[model samples]
Target: MTKHLSTPLANSMGIQDQVSFHRTELAIILSLYGRMVAAGEWRDYGISALKNLAVFSVYRRTAEVPMYRIEKRPKLRLQQGQYSVVGMDGKVLRRGRDLKQVLRVLERKLIRAVD
Candidate 1:
């Protein structure tokens, strides 16, 4: 048996809303992070869960701005897909319904940085 925790949110519609990555999602992201770290392309990362979005920020160093941000916005799912990878310059590198596909953009960057 397993126990799961639930968090209550502040909202007026009498509806509960929680934005966060699932365990499997985190596993996938962490695997990429591990590879980038081993390749010496990434040093630090952060995760944030807001009312409408979940973000994974990657940084070269703790003090620097995130080099990339992977965002998930369920509101955008039907219209334009929920997964997006944004570069430091605030450009959308890729956006799609598949997280692994969107993350491939960063994999290319790792190759470039390593060489």
Candidate 2:
């Protein structure tokens, strides 16, 4: 029989040790989505929580690539800001400490003439 020095449970998240969204952050994101959805500008969305990042992707259609991505990287909380909105072109639309403000860049897309 072979003996291992470390236990199998050394690096893993248990069922209950999962990551979750902050209430304020969720409110900001969902509010934006709600407005976009009501305007028929967004059709679908997805969320991803990885080891070093949390991403919220917005889609114009179910089969196509996401139109936008809202990301949270805690590591950048001190450097270039933790929250960022990335466009479909993989460009950074905005980055800041406040989620609502960073998201304003996306809201700008919804603006149009009232004719």
Candidate 3:
């Protein structure tokens, strides 16, 4: 069996009362990715789980900056809300405590006119 290294948060920060993505985060992010792919709006994506944050970045092309970044920061869980959707310019489209609500910002992009 392999041993896992402990981090500062695990050894010191202890249990945080703040909310996080949990399992549903993956489902929500993946669902959005699928729709964006089908719409031909997104070509690539990346996920990052940092010490204090988690980021889901959507890219139209590999070299260019991500078109959108869905981030989860537990430290800002209460102050700015845990979930946030940011645009390419790093502009926050939405931030809230509810994951579903925070994700709604992206869902709006999926809407199209019946032409």
CA-lDDT, candidates in order = 0.89, 0.87, 0.85
Point out the higher-scoring one by TM-score: 2 or 3: 2
The digit string of per-residue lDDT tens for model 1 on 32-109 reads 999999989999999999889999999999999999999999999899999999999999999999989989988876
lDDT of 3 at 84: 91
Better of 1 and 3 by lDDT: 1
lDDT of 3 by residue, 1-115 (tens): 9776766675686744433456878897898799989999999998877767888899999998999999999878779898899999989999998888998988888899998
How many Å off is the CA of 49 in candidate 3?
1.2
lDDT of 2 by residue, 1-115 (tens): 9987655584454433324458789888999899999999998999988777889999999999999999998889899899999999999999998888899898897899999
- Residue pairs in candidate 2 whose N, alpha carbon or C atoms collide under 3 angstroms: none
Name the regions of candidate 3 deviating beyond 4 angstroms: 1-21
Cα lDDT over the full model 1 = 0.89
Error of 1 at 41 (Å): 0.5
TM-score for each model: 0.82, 0.83, 0.79
- Best candidate per TM-score, number? 2
Model 2 weakest lDDT span, ten residues long: 11-20
